[model samples]
Target: MPPRPRPRPRVAVVVFPGSNCEQDVAYALNWLGLDSAYVWHGDHSLDGFGAVVLPGGFSYGDYLRCGAIARFSPIMDAVTRFARAGRPVLGICNGFQILAEAHLLPGALLRNAGLKFICRDVALRVEARCDWLDAPTGSVLHLPINHNEGNFVCDSATLDDLRADDRVIVRYCDEEGRTDGVSAPNGALDNIAGITNAARNVFGLMPHPERAVDPTVGGSDGQLVFQSLLQQFTQEVF
Candidate 1:
């Protein structure tokens, strides 16, 4: 007999007071026929969700720091617990900053090197086939990024460690997938665009994949990330 199909995993999009991308993420999943729901920041449980997303936008008005205050949200406790269980967790843009702040992932997001908010579609190259990306290495993806503090930074040792462990999942690149300084929009260290934890389950990136999920909007490179999650988790009984 053929292998039995497992139930699709439900995704939860965390929404903080200043999060503006929660609905966009939910819509992206719903548009792709996947199950997803919004979880308020005050909620302390993520019991049934198989995956979680910390979407983009200024949380707590970016007070003190971009994600410094939001890291203490009630839902983050549950998120931290979920991450400890080795489930998939994604952080995009401001969300990436939170992941860094929560220590769920390494490195931190700093102000743009140019000191200006950047909003544009840019080219990216898959550096590793982590849980969030199924694309072949060197494959180019075009995704939109919107933020002022999207520049990623880390100590030299940490950068070396991430490089050694192959945790650098993606890098800003030219349309031809060349990893040159000119292609790096925010002057991120090592042109890093995204990364995954040692376990490869927890992922964070500055670009808004959800915004690029629709063909009508221009690019669909972002869909592969979501599809990879659906394909991976839906195949196993969770």
Candidate 2:
């Protein structure tokens, strides 16, 4: 008999109590012909999943701080282990806050410099290549962002290390892909919009890539992010 076809990789989209973007992420993954399943916050295991995504939304009602309460969710333990194993993990917006709170990625997201919620499409320049984002460096991606505290901040030492190691995955940029404070919607330090862990497996960004996958609704630049992930899985690079 001919060799059997490999099963499609399955991504686990963790759903917290107030998470509103889980379905969006699932739809984007399914649109790309990949399998996706929702993992409740109370679940303790992430077995049989090829990747994990913590979608954007208000977790635990954003009490105390964004993601501060969600960090203790029962499923976070599994998510932590999955990340440590070098598996791909992508967190968006509030998801980014959760990753930071869990210490899976460096830095903390502070209130917007203007102290007002911002929701709009912004230009992002890919600063580095990683498992989650394989787009060419300096490429521009326009994605939507909606949050009150999307400003990314880190200690000076960590900032130096991130720059030296090329861990800054993306930065807010102008139409010409020039990064500066003027282009930063939330005043993120160094115009950072996204970053990856030292292993380059865990990626967290404040933009809503899930909301930009379909050209009908908006642009399709967000598809690049998911496409890169699927490529990695197809190559068995996980």
Candidate 3:
């Protein structure tokens, strides 16, 4: 008999009306050899996919709240279910707001400390031993961040719980990858830029790694994140 065909990993990138990075995310995934596609906000089925990504954009125009209206969309119901199964779920920028709004993740993203919409390249340090990156303990990943509401805040007790649970992902840092009192654009707690749900399957962040996939664009630091996740899922399913 012919060798068994390796199963292709799949990703569902949720598309809200204002989502601008869906294609960028898809391109990145496809380039990385994953079977990925865009899932409309109205599509409620996640049958063929093992992973889901909520791409960055101004969902609902950041009205009322960043992801307030998006949490009520039809597809989010399915996204929640996938997350419950311990499937990988990633949310970027506005998608981070939606996840927090849905209570899939903790804390809330507030306006920047400077009270201005900031957009530029910012350095980040990976804090925990994560399946999504599997990066070395002190690895630093530099990428772009663009948002009006990128401040991450939670109560002291909750923050402590997150730390103990190891839910924190990317954190703001300087060229030296220090997470001290250096303020990037917003004053995120402990310089936090990304976090995962209690289960670690659901992740959300403010930076755009998809936007930095090419050396022609100045850096390819974000590609490791996708590779790490791909390796993680392949090890389990294959």
**Top-scoring candidate (lDDT):** 2
- The model with the greatest TM-score is 2
lDDT of 2 by residue, 57-91 (tens): 99999999999999999999999999999999999
The TM-score of candidate 1 is 0.96
Candidate 3 residue 15 Cα shift, in angstroms, is 0.3
Task: State the displacement of the C-alpha of residue 25, model 2, in Å, after optimal TM-score superposition.
Answer: 0.3
> For residues 1-238, could you state the per-residue lDDT of candidate 3 as single tens digits?
9988788768888999789889988988887787898899989898888788899998788889999999999999899998898888889899899999999999999999899898899999888755556677568888999899999999999899888887788889988888877886788887889888777778889998888876676478878778877887678764
lDDT tens readout by residue for model 1, 2-101? 9786668799999999999998899888877789989999999999998999999999999998999999999999999999889889999989999999
Off by over 4 Å in 3: 1-4
Candidate 2: pairs in clash: none
Cα lDDT, all candidates: 0.91, 0.93, 0.86
**Which runs of model 1 end up more than 4 angstroms from their true locations?**
1-6, 181-183
Over 4 Å off in model 2, which ranges? none
Score residue 16 of candidate 2 by CA lDDT. 98
How many residue pairs clash in each candidate at the backbone level?
Answer: 0, 0, 0
Candidate 1 residue pairs that clash:
none
Ranking by TM-score: 2, 1, 3
Q: In model 1, how many backbone clashes occur? A: 0
